[model samples]
Target: MATTDTQPKRLPILTFCAGHMAVDWPHGAFWVLQPPIALAMGLSPSQMGLMVALTAVGATLSLLPAGMLSDHTRRRGPVFAGTFVWVVVGYGLASLAPDFWTLTLMLAIAGMGTSAWHPLATGTLTQTMAGQRARVLGIHAMGGTLAEVFAPLLTGVLLLYLDWREGLALAVIPAAVVGIIFFQARDRLTVETASAARLGDLKEMMQQWTSKTGLALVSMISIYNMAVMSVLAMATLYIVNDLGFSVFWGGVAFSAMILAGAVFQPIMGHLSDTMGRRKIFAISLFAAAPLGFAMPFIGSPWVAIGFLIVMIGAFYGVRSVVLASAVDFAGKREGTTLGLAFTLMDGVGALGAFLGGWAGDFDLAYAFALASGFAMISGTIALGSTLAFPKIQAEPAE
Candidate 1:
């Protein structure tokens, strides 16, 4: 295993963690306000859905390239720098948008920023704590979950006190600070940890998709992402438009779900680290399916809110378990493998978001059912793949 003997103490990990946290904040904040933002901008629900889709588009486009770049450079500086700048620019553009076209372009740029972060960050985390990949990834992933939990609540509060533009502008500050930390920690990043694998090497990796465990993990990721995106993008709309809830209550519902997930993610990750990824992965998915299916049936607003909390919590908790399985299957080339799987899964999931919006427009209950079906698909994939994958044990640091 490669080592970063000369790297600074803990600053690199701390800074990278902060950057991860900051990137997801805007996503959470924006989604909570999406319905109102669409109304305020005079856009249709489908058009608003497209805006959310565009971010995934940006992320999907960048995933493979970011992984390749991280492998070649072994340094996270460039990735973090690009992500921070593009996110800030994207938010600024979103703030200044005069029409849907401008907003679309802005989101596309922001999507690029969002896209750049994961592969590089995941790669860095894997490298930084080589042997303890699952635990570290869990810790890193928690940062994003934390942001998801807070962004909607903060955005709602800011919107209550100030305008959307002010709220968006305020959102950029954290990214800027994250950027500074990334730059300061540049010296601590080890270039060798970035695999010297060329594009040709990645091509060879693509050929290894014959591995049943790898394929299964990827399949599970796809189903899970589809379910997650569908819910995140459309839940607020359902609450606001169909259930007769105010935007504030809608935001609260979104926040509650995220908070539930945020609380459980680290615990799930830790369990995956200790109890075996497959066991936890299967349990989470199986539990989440019923919770998801039941979401739209509860008529009382508070009951619906409570159900969402349980549903999203189970969804994100299982997500960590599934992602850890990727590392388990990838073994040596965790970055490339993780990146490729995520890109494909999330790309397909983006389509799920579109379907969700369409479903919500017709019937919110149907949309919830659709998400539940995907969760069931994910659960099945996890159960079928468990026996095929090797048991993963954390490696001792070199």
Candidate 2:
């Protein structure tokens, strides 16, 4: 029988982080690729809305099953490594898609790989570093953030010389390599699965998530995620179509947004680990609201990009903190809890993306305003929940 490696090794974590980096590469490119692909297919704004909605459909469908599997399975390395290859295949097929619906279907399949990643990867990390979950999860987030920051910039550069299809095809090669490496290193990275979860435990977990405080936390995660998806989808379109910027600038703008978050993530996570998750999470959402509201009005390319930086920096910075908070509330079934949170997040986000896209068809400003409203409302809910549950203030990760 294989024994668990109780001590965390640097190399294993690095391999894990690389796997995260590889799986997320395609997602990072989504914003930059959407405009050219829409133009190539002659898709209307409504069709673009449909595309965003559909992109999340597969993710929402897969997350819960993946989470349950992760919780029960002893060896997660195979599944974890497989998610990387899954993304490669999805993107490869997407590159060859001949029509709008075909491309949407393939991209949606790719989204599943990313959605499944969070529950398995993050759940294991939370268990491993149960005491310092926010900090470790923050580091894991940086790996994905690095890919998100570079993938679009790289795709933008590729666009100058190659078609979007070729750019997507080229991305598959690196992800495939990472998958193989992860497979080879599976022994080192395998999660020591918790004792087999029972049906009663699962049912109890569901009840906890639906309780009053649990409902408040879920509301914050879902509403905030919806606003994030809407803003990102609309912001990408607004930059390329309304502002008349090249795809390169669109990539730069997207990278700026992610890079800012990357810089703030570790800081936010450390603060939350010491300061408590609720305050940090609520503060970040509140800070982001005004910047998102201000984005549509800015006409200058550089200023608009600057706003993207600060806005996303605030929200995405605390993302892991929010996840860590949910795990704290879960008290058990960390993987399943994360799965439910992500399912709600992506499900609501899909609807918001569709609505934002449709609103963009009439006026891009409407999309921005709508997104701002979401952030504002989310911040209000988070603040209210924190005040109502004062005992939860400064709750420890353990």
TM-score versus the correct structure, for each prediction: 0.90, 0.94
lDDT of 2 by residue, 188-279 (tens): 66565667867877788878878899899888888888787777777677778877889998888888888888888889999988877877
Candidate No. with top lDDT? 2
Q: Tell me the tens digit of each residue's lDDT in model 1 across 159-273.
A: 7777767777787777888877777766665556534767677767776665665577667788888888887878888778877887677777788888788778778877777
In TM-score terms, candidate 2 sits at: 0.94
Clashing pairs in 2: none
Q: What's the distance in Å from true for residue 302, model 2?
A: 2.4
CA lDDT of every candidate? 0.72, 0.79
| Ten-residue stretch with the least lDDT total in model 2 | 1-10
